[model samples]
Target: MPILRNTKKEAVIKDITVIGGGVVGASTALHLASLGYQITIVDQNNSNIAKNSEHRTGSTASLGVLMGNIFTRHKGRSWELRKRSMEIWPELIKSLSTEELPIIVNTPLVKIASSKEEMIKMENLIKQKKYLGIDFLPDNYQSLPIWIKNKYGGLISYNDGQINSLKLIDSLFLKLKSLNVNIITSKVKYIKRINDNTRIWSVILEDGKAINSHIVIICAAAESERLLQQLNYKLPLTKILGQAIKLKFKNSQVNFSGWPAIVNIKGINLIPEQPDSLLIGATLENELSPDKKYLHQMLETIREKAEWMQNYLIKEKWYGHRAKPINEPAPILKSIEKGLIINTAHYRNGVLLSPACAEWVSLEINKFHQ
Candidate 1:
């Protein structure tokens, strides 16, 4: 193990250095910190880039939809990660709540079926989920909200909920601060293993600063590919552009209380915000720029189903890129080497799966040490 000298010239064992300060990275730091590991987080912390909607990270641009329970896949790594995350979210929210950080929006997720095929799939899932003790409301047109106009009805997953992504990140940083985790605001230039025998790694920052640690976890999303490529590891990651629009209901009398976040079979989400506004997103486009037509079409689809939205005014539209794996499953959660971990490429479900991904990283570290 690599040891460093403190100001008093005493030997101090180095610990973990996590690259990336987004939701996944922040959550991973918190998880590791709670486990008594000395943790350091290196983030670029570009305020101007974060402010620009087009350049915002996936977590910031997301509508914060937690669709774990509603996901049709009942088996595989994806489902397992979603299941684990759903279990952790409540505990995390409660812990954060003690600090008066209201990051979670407690509401069920309602997934509406656009076709008979989707309804059948939901039916089969309801049966399969019942065996696992996952509750799902019976699909009934009358059971849906008054505004939703779907002929095939919808399924409600009470266990699923949403969170404010930005707020969650902020609260996580505060929690990390209370835990005394070191957070560095700089971009990582490259990462290299300092000693093969000792398994110690060095994270080199853009400003020529090197942070030495026993373990390094890469949660830098699209940037992970570049970082790994320098180490002769090809991490194929493609950036998928996603756009969302915020709209406000013109009619103040519109009641959004107790409303569940709605998701269509096409994967577009219509989330109800506080007051009389709704956040509708997002389009997975391959192009560079935000396509206004995609947002328009999505809005029209929602307006067609929910007539009340016809009178709403467009508030704002934003876009962000999500890192997706090439020819591989989402979330690329695994240790690439003895001490280097890759936990990025969550794609669209970064916020939804962050807690589980973080826990997985912690478990990997423990297992390796054992």
Candidate 2:
């Protein structure tokens, strides 16, 4: 491992260099840092990207949104990894002493349905038998309650929970900083094939500075595909455009309305961060940004959810790309080269899967030394 000074400001290098500072990159750094690896991060956008990538990306989002259902589809080892990852929040909270972590307290992971058919679909889903028992959540989210039941979200599952994604990313970055991870601001210009493309490699920053390492993991979201292709590894991945919104509400029935997180109807999901306000999102597509047409549809969806929303205006908006690997629901963690690894195609579970993903990657890094 390279050296990191205890002093406040010093330009010391590290053994690991991560090519993104978003949640994935931050989580990757933090996990490895705890293992005593000298780490570095690079990204053009900081925490603010989560605040508003909608207008900036020309995308519009609705009140309810989703990341698809990794929770409901897990099987065996895949299911176990997700469950264990969900349980990491408590330790994550203490690690992030700063920013008040988003209230991920147990709330109903519901399938609130508007009609009988949908509710029946929910009933049939939970009853389906599989060794992994992946079909646990109701088929539709409408079956959920308006608020928490019995001081919590009810006996939901052993491992499912919510997170203030953006805030969580911010907190992770700080924690990694406290761990002395070096964050370079330039984009990665190219990769240096240390031996052969299949054996060892390093990367060159856009500025022409090369960061060599014994092991490298690519956590660069949609860019993961490009990274893999550059290494001659075939990865089945695609980028889906998603939009999110923040709305200020009025007289609402949803208690804990300010802090409840739900995967709501019409592909809309929300996490109310404040009283009378919630962050709603997500539309899926191959496009890079949301056109005006898509944005208008989003507004209409929110309007249909609650008549009272007619009075409530948007407090904020955001848009971003989520990567997904269609071949397998689980992330692709196999080595593309002897010294290089791939850790992307996480889809919307990016935040949810960070801890587990990082842990998996860190283990591989440690195994390299052995």
Candidate 3:
């Protein structure tokens, strides 16, 4: 473990390297850059993974649903992370919006209850969260959208919303560049301690390049396990496959105005990408490739509720791998060693939890200097 020290006259400025360029990594870089650290982000730039049908990263494949206030869990680590992120999201979005970045769609999230049992659960949740601006609607509610067919009631969380993950990352990078943070397009081969005494890290790239940093935070999702193995440190992480599809409405006059950006039916999410297009998806599987059967089954579930969905044509389909921790709670946000931190393995909640996790990484780095 490296020992970091600061002089009394002035605080030492440290070089920090983040090993992923996804939402989590980009958010971390932006947060650290705000703290006036020398930041460098390295990513392999696998942007074309969708066209190539390769292993897609979680950030790009996500539907970007932010269900913080709507989450069932009200207490525990998960809730804490979600709460913190929710608190930061508004300010973050406002700051970004000041720069004219359209990263988030500020709309409420509607979670429909498909079964009577689910309806009862939602009813109880509505009572419990009455102070949180959550609204419950019965099946006969007058304002329910005509497109959705529901026998059971639903809950609407006004504070929860959806994000445009791709735009969020792009906006963060733009902010990083404005802050003079260095962005590198490369793959890190491994990281090793420069010396036992100084605690500096030598981040070696595949191209025979080595960049030294005072701190290294691994936000590489499932790839973090392989990187840690190089240092003989083990963190059990597995990749969970999630698939989603985009659909375009055939009817040009279809009216979807004033609709919430996200509508979660059962375990599936329906997102509005545009007025005439919808994004539905996300099946969690333990395989490397997408399961067509599962994807269709999810679509079928949605189709059963909304017959109008039959008029929509599939525009695109994509899948990505999310990192899940085996036998551990998700979102391993902590410093394993003095100068080494791991903030990956967020699984499906990467988009929702990245901001809080990034703040965690920055605090850990600050602790070292203290």
Candidate 4:
């Protein structure tokens, strides 16, 4: 272990440095800290270049849906990751007693099928997953709230929920500060190997200072590939661009905060945010310039199902990139070298997979000592 030393030449503590301060990085650091590891987090906070970049990264922009049994296509790695995350979410939320935790709205999700074909597709999917606590509503849509429109019925998935992404980020930041984790708001220029024979490394910051540590975990999202390539590891990953908007209803009687989020069979989601406020999103594009026609099509899809949205205006519009491994659906969690690990490529499930990803990485860190 590399000892963190003070100017007095005294070995204070052994340090574990985590790069990327986004939800995955932050959550990983927190889990390591809780396990009594002296931790330091290095993040540029520059969205343009950092892999685990955090300026309105997917974590902040997400509608915070823990979508285990909702709109997912199959029970693949994506489904397993979400299932594990949902299992640990409550315990993780309750553990944050240092401050008021983020608002995790434990409401059902209403998956509305616009056509009989779509309904049949959803019904077959339900059978494949055999998920509990979710039931297809009556053909008359009796169980769904009065606000839900359209003619077809819906499936209500219990315990599927949403959270305030901004608030959740705030709470995580606060908890990290309280834990005395050193958070450096600077870019890591690159990593330097201290020795070839020994498993030791140092992160070279933009300011030319080297932060030495025994373990260096790279949670940088799309940026991880470049950093790893510099060290001769080829990580095949790509970035997908997505856009979403927030809207507030003009009518005071319209309240969605307590109602279940409406997941259109056509890939649009309406998540309740605050009183009369809702989050509608998101368009995924791989190219730099998203096709305007495709974006318009998504908007048209949303309007077709929920005519009530005509009463509200867009409150905010934003777009960001999500990371995905070239061929893998699950996140990449592995030790690249003796003291180096990489955890990224979460794609659209970053928020949903935060806890599970953090736990998986932290366990690897623990295993290194044992």
Q: Model 3 over residues 24-100: C-alpha lDDT tens digits?
A: 99888888877778899888884333443434678888888888877777899899888888878887876665346
Clashing pairs in 1: none
Per-candidate total of colliding backbone pairs: 0, 19, 0, 5
lDDT of the candidates, in the order given = 0.79, 0.58, 0.81, 0.72
Which residues of candidate 3, in runs, are more than 4 Å off?
1-10, 46-55, 98-100, 138-145, 252-254
**What is the Cα-based lDDT of residue 341 in candidate 2?**
65
Question: Tens digits of per-residue lDDT for model 4 on 17-113?
Answer: 9999888898888777766778999888732232223225766666677776664455666666677777777777766534345455556777887
Q: State the TM-score for model 3.
A: 0.92
- Candidate 4 lDDT (Cα, whole model)? 0.72
TM-score of 2: 0.76
Error of 2 at 21 (Å): 1.9
Off by over 4 Å in 2: 1-14, 47-70, 99-108, 114-118, 124-159, 196-200, 250-259, 298-305, 326-330
RMSD of each: 5.2, 7.1, 4.1, 5.9
Q: How far is candidate 3 from the true structure (C-alpha RMSD, Å)?
A: 4.1
Candidate 3 lDDT (Cα, 0 to 1)? 0.81
Give residue 144's lDDT in candidate 2 (0 to 100).
40
* Tens digits of per-residue lDDT for model 1, 200-303: 89999989989999899999999999999999999898889999888887886665765665544468887777668888889988877788788778877777
Ordered list by TM-score, greatest first: 3, 1, 4, 2
TM-score of each: 0.90, 0.76, 0.92, 0.85
Candidate 4 residue spans exceeding 4 A from truth: 1-14, 46-55, 71-76, 97-102, 124-131, 138-150, 251-258, 262-264, 289-294, 368-370
